[model samples]
Target: MSATTQDAVQHHDHHGPEKGLKRWIFTTNHKDIGTLYLLFALIMLFVGGAMSLVIRAELFQPGLQFVNPDFFNQMTTLHALVMVFGMIMPAFAGFANWMIPLMIGAPDMALPRLNNWSFWLLPFAIIMLAMTLFLPGGAPAAGWTLYPPLVLQTGDAFPFMVFSIHLLGISSIMAAINIIVTILNMRAPGMSLLKMPLFVWSWLITAYLLIAVMPVLAGGVTMLLTDQFFGTSFFQAAGGGDPVLFQHIFWFFGHPEVYIIILPAFGIISHVIPTFSRKPLFGHDSMVFATGSIAFLSFIVWAHHMFTVGMPLAGQLFFMMATMLIAVPTGVKVFNWIATMWKGAITFETPMLFALAFIVQFTFGGFTGLMLAIAPADFQYHDSYFVVAHFHYVLVNGALYGAFAGVFYWLPKMTGHMYNDKLSKIYFWISTFFINVTFFPQHFLGLAGMPRRIPDYATQFTDFNAMSSIGAFGFGLSQLLLVYIVIKTIKGGEKATGEVWEEAQGLEWTVSSPPEYHSFETAPDIK
Candidate 1:
């Protein structure tokens, strides 16, 4: 073995952990924190998923059966809050915590103590928010958007929800700052900015975006609190304040927040697709540029989400056109992925299957988003099941699918055992099929003028709603298999080789399966 390899092996021997539960709780190690973030996200995933199932169940028929309108509204609100803050964002952070050090050949995150604190804050924040449901007036019934007038109408739960959101935002910002500093200042001697893996590059941009926008969300929510209690009228029309401004500010942050979730997913896909195809990524420069362009376009397109809130023709047109322009860069990415797979030595592993599904489903979501960007069409579609369907395609099928892909792809590295391939494929197939069944029909329902957030609907919408609900249950239940696969893999299986996949590349692949607590004590020489 070469001198560098010898040093790395010796370094690994020196810093590896002695396994125990206390090691996880009190540990500041990046890999340990990453596991905590992921396991926490998985638990939140089930919690949020259950909330969604309740919404689907209530919407299953033409009338409310499982829940009252107020309870239904609470479910809708908390479902979004938990999923966005609790599940999706943390999942990405978990990916960063785990992969960033290994990818960049850093021994650990720059500020390890803060990393532990950031993760521990999550469970407490979520508990505080969840406790609001049992408060006298129940949880904040306003949507996760948390507009002023509606939010002000809710009970004491509003303050708790707002504070919880603030806590969540703070946690995210700290995590983002840590990632940015580590990637910027802590990379091993030979790793250049551009030479970093796509996952790191994507995250670098995502962190910057988070730092810029999360404060805006915090400020908006803070104003909402003032409006409710301090007698301020930031969103009250009668008090000479315009509620529309809340949207303006919210979407300013909200639009980029959407990119914040998906961009990392893009990074993961960029990494996985190339590895599985046994080829270099097609248009690597263009992929980076496309990601940057999407982040840029995200800001100007905020108003597209508010098209129905009223704007002058020119303003509406400007926002619509800017939103549509996002398709160019996004399209570039799609074509590049397809081209990468063209005539390549493709393997149908679980990760590759999820990546392939993401390409198709995310593109379908993007197309619908483009159609919604048309202001005239949006007027009809606004607040309907179509809007619900659109985001589920993007968020659930897009972001969530990417998370699953990453988990399956990296399981071997994270745990020292290979997952059961037969069970993995079965989980993927069942999820893909049922996911489509759940969300696809909602598009038709939206077109048929079924309004969202309603506890009841007309009898004509019954058939599709029932079908969608059944599919929701199927999708929800299928996740049990995922839980099983993860547990079984962790328990014990066939040992994984250093290179988990036959054609995997990057600094990460250079390390052993279940990488050492302190990886790359001596950095690899990047060729």
Candidate 2:
């Protein structure tokens, strides 16, 4: 190395993070930025969870019990917005920022300044989104899908909501760009594409997906803005526009956005399952191919979400077959996870427990999706509680559980302290049990002809509704234990070794627990 470059590297390494709030505000360090993303996501999780409890409490036993219908709808809309944009997406980004460079032996993200800008955009967007509740119309009551002309009725807060979404889209796109550049350009010597860790591979594909679709979402919302104010008839039937066109546009982005949410979790599972099972991942190359195949199929399956909208027979058939095709790749993933654990020295640690539950419950979601994919069957199921149940299974059990597993698996490395095993297991079991109790009965409710998004329900739906509300409370309250466990681990715990897990492999394990401020100051040589 040139002496000038060597001296500059030493000078950069000598400084630590600044003290107090400015550190978070102005710092370009990837780990600090990652912490910011994670902490923000954690705060938003509770915020969204609280909105859900309101929805559940109102639905617990009755006809307009705690909240009016409009407010209840607002709760549903805000809950989805907060969870999807504010909580889950950022949490995965946090995992990306903190772990990707470590895993790939880079000093940091390829674009550190842009990374800082990306994270800071999220808070402002979410805050503006939340503030709309106090506006004249309360919040947007048209659901997270924001279908018009219902959404166009939103008073005073309409522009704020649209602009908030714009900011969010911009933020996500910037983060995606940063990830793509870093992964493509910054891998250490000898760390070829196929040799990179699974988590990195997952994020790489997810980043591409993000860049591709986020703009589509932006365009849809921009059209919503124009229709609301500028006398454009892009979606207004009165202005020679078809509202169905909006559905086509939105779902085109929306369906891929689902994969954008889950793929990172798939990556997390790949890492966690292998480590806990004490085996190299089964079918590694096939896993890679399957992930790509699922992504490719996501674009074609968008119409399944709208099968009941009176599509042509050929269109329905094509979409039905395409939606079912997704199961091929997903099934490969499920089989590979089980096979990885087969006859291996499996240990049911907190991470593995979550990963196992993810496989089971996510499969339940997939089966329900298959049921919904049949256009004729979807006629009976569309907008019912069954659809609600299916997605929650995929998102909560699939994506959120994967995030939990990642956190538990990596906390030791992040904090340089081992989390309490007993507390973590308790957290896991409580979450797993109540999550089922919360959503499983919704399937029966849908089958029995109950619709979703209504504040009041028929008396016959009371029992399962009550059960779900109770479970919601149990599940929501149980997450506090996670906060406590993380805090306890951070404040003090058993010291962690460099390789926190027994068979944990990767460049990440080679660094110190909690790692240097500038990890891989000297680029690692891959063998």
Which candidate's lDDT is highest? 2
Clashing pairs in 1: none
Please give the TM-score that candidate 1 achieves against the real structure: 0.97
Worst 10 residues of 2 by lDDT: 1-10
- State, as a TM-score between 0 and 1, how close model 2 is to the true structure: 0.98
Clash pairs, candidate 2, are none
Instruction: State how far residue 111 of model 2 sits from its true place (Å).
Output: 0.4
Tally clashes: model 1: 0
Q: What overall lDDT goes with each candidate model?
A: 0.92, 0.93
Q: Write the per-residue lDDT of candidate 1 for residues 24-49, one digit (tens) a residue.
A: 87898999999999999999999999
